[model samples]
Target: MRLSIPIQSHYYERKRIMRLFEAKNLTKKYDKTVLDHLDFSINEGEVVGVIGVSGCGKSTLARLVSGIEKPSSGSLLYQGKPVDFKKGRKDIQLILQNSIESFSPRMKIRVFLYEPYHYFYHLHKNEALDCIKKILKQVGMDESCLEKYPHELSGGQLQRIAIARALIIHPRLLICDEITSSLDHVVQREIIELLKKFVEKNHISILFISHDLSLVHEFCHQVLVLNNGKIIEKGTIQQLYKSENEVVQNLLKAAYLNS
Candidate 1:
């Protein structure tokens, strides 16, 4: 017999009032400090872009938020509570730049996509296959690709599969760490457009990390500029364009020239 799951009214209420994810004084250090005390938050369904020059702690911040690395000092809260990366929370998902490295070469694409569903939802084989087919279709992949190994696919195709893997778990917040840096301009634009549609349709929030300021300006609702591990500037694209900060100005100039 199928069971009916009652929706939690408080979930919607919290979505209206609380941030999907929040970081307060988030710091990470190794031999040297990588990320300083950083403060940022993303509301439900908001796309927040993080941009900085190389070595500005952009990837470090993504690691901290995604729970790949622990913070030395600071707090990360998801849904108004402390984030427990160890618990394997499905609400937060992180997609990395190297999709091929993330997968097992020995395994077929179907295994990569099916494992999450089986583990998280305990679905039967047919059920898992159905879910996988749906997600693959949404990501513009066909069934033939499912039988291929990771090495058999192109970079853009693997990246889309990685995205489908993340979305299969139904995450509330998605952290993308330079996911498009490896792709060409056309592929990057396609991925960004796909993410925009996914975010709008599912009401999911994204923390997009990229060095491409032009892409960030086009895609993000708000932009955070990180310098020396701290947020040096943050604003909407228009507000940032009007700012006089040297760092922001330099980035804007670079972006303009690149475009």
Candidate 2:
């Protein structure tokens, strides 16, 4: 006798712009592997938190997904198709923690914002400047920032400006690699709130990478726990909080109970 299992009708109801299947086994060095084997899926418009220890390769995984770094031997499928680094999808963008280094020391801040449009949309100088001003305003940065250099701004301001540049392109998948780690707690909260608002309004998918599990819990719908490049645990925010894994338990304790 054969038996058929029933499927939930609503399981396939939601729409997704991109999905990462497996995302496994990224071996950086033969002797000391960075990511042993990892797995997670991010639905469109979902905020996926990546939480792990300092050396667990959380940022490395973000780079891999953004095509900034190549995985040694693992497959990453974006929208069910394999990720091709050489011919990368233009809709993906990465916001690194140290936004200062990401910018050119010689260029003005406005150039940083307009350059992407000049490449992708062929917008003229005046049009690009207007677009840049609009995005900078959206991120709570003043027009005066457009004339300043990276050295002229504070760490928090630079980070916000960097985020504005990333959002200016209206990317579908935004990879944030510890983007607010250096900011003050107040600024951090504000930045997170701004990003959340953008995601809600634009339907953008976010892979937020951070070592702070508490922050992740407050922001993401689902969380992926990484240690030495392996996914020790992964589930919804509630499930992760109630997880029994020692590393996760300890991290949560340190962030909340211990602190």
Candidate 3:
């Protein structure tokens, strides 16, 4: 299964605003400790980035937030109430890193896009088609691919379409799990630009998880450096660069050097 999000994350204190999604003492264990009382939040209309090494529980956190998996011993609150995955899912959308397996092999692009519309809004085919057309164009695609299966498109095209599909239902929170990791730098920029435009136009909150520090720095307003299931560092891009923590310092060095 792909990563889903809201992560019951913790929002910081700079703005003193209420959290859109907040994770309190979140802990998950699979074979061993995956998350250990982790804490973070996302405010309304904010883009919060989570950066960490591979297998560092980033995906686990995403799953918990998205309701794909539940927290072992913690509370996930949305707007001061316990999040109801059944209804909360409508307001949260997740875009995974794997665009290839994102859809069913038997389904056409049309069916995939229309499912959310029908399920959530009960929109008729014609109404859904209209919205899909607009979203497709927004994600730099068109209606011509409606008849084609996922295999017929390029990686970039599939990813764009995946994004369009998620945004179609107008979720308040978008969870991105390494969505750009598989694309080329150019395609990555295009997708990020599309997200930026959408965020500017909509009051959506985003939880962006990535291994690429550079990409996170370019896109997120604030970031948390995840390590051993806890946030070791949290701040703006510029502030992070000035971190005195050794782990943060080494991570910055490695990320920039590889970039």
Candidate 4:
């Protein structure tokens, strides 16, 4: 299914003006609240970063936005309408942190990369191979990678392939949940650079969820600081630096110390 936003009468005008995705009072709960009345938006071609401590609902928010899990009592809108998670939108893709675990053990990298193309675009085998080759190269991988299994590759290589898989569908919004948490600083920097190039070239938005304040500061145009399921602070990196909130201040201090 090649998922697409239905063209409205004023599609071009709306495209120029409206947010690509928006969450209004989005809340999720299990036995207890995971996310509480969260509100955020992503404009076209912009990168918005979400930062919080562990269990602060960062992953939950990503799930809600990408339709992996629905919000318990709030709304998620894509192009100003309620998103149907059951229908599965191809334009919103989520890349999880565990790249190795995300793939099937028995499947080759070829199958991992090809399945999305087959499912979404229904491309011919040759066409799919061509597309996969192009995407892998974009992520700085080569054709030989297609013959390998997930475990055969390094963490950085697997993560790059994971990103390649997400990009196959040409998503409007890429929700990255702790994507750099497991990698070393050097690999993390490379991945961030790749993402920066991808976002710019494709003209898409990103909802980047990370605990690394330094990475977020370097990549995102705006930042949201979540605490206890609520947005404790939000603004551009410069604005965040000027924040008087204790939580934001402490996070900045930690990021600076680590740097």
lDDT scores in order: 0.86, 0.78, 0.85, 0.85
Q: Write the per-residue lDDT of candidate 3 for residues 101-144, one digit (tens) a residue.
A: 87999999999999999998999999889889989999999789
Worst 10 residues of 2 by lDDT: 1-10
Local lDDT at 24 for model 3: 87
* lDDT (Cα) of model 3: 0.85
lDDT of 1: 0.86
Kindly provide the TM-score of model 4 when superposed on the true structure, using C-alpha atoms: 0.91
The residue-by-residue lDDT of candidate 1 on 143-197, one tens digit each, is 9998999999989999999999999999899999999989998899889888988
Q: Estimate each model's TM-score.
A: 0.92, 0.88, 0.92, 0.91
**Model 4 per-residue lDDT tens digits across residues 44-87:** 87889998778888888988898888779989888888886655
Off by over 4 Å in 1: 1-17
Kindly list the per-residue Cα lDDT of model 2 for residues 1-259, writing each as its tens digit: 1111212123235654455433645555446788775667777777888987788888778878888777778678776878665655557789988899999998999888888888878999898888887888788989998899999999889998888878877777899999988887788878988887887788788899987655676678778888877888887666876888899888777667532
How displaced is residue 11 in candidate 1, in Å? Answer: 20
Misplaced by over 4 Å in model 2 are 1-27, 257-259
All models, RMSD in angstroms: 7.9, 7.3, 5.5, 7.2
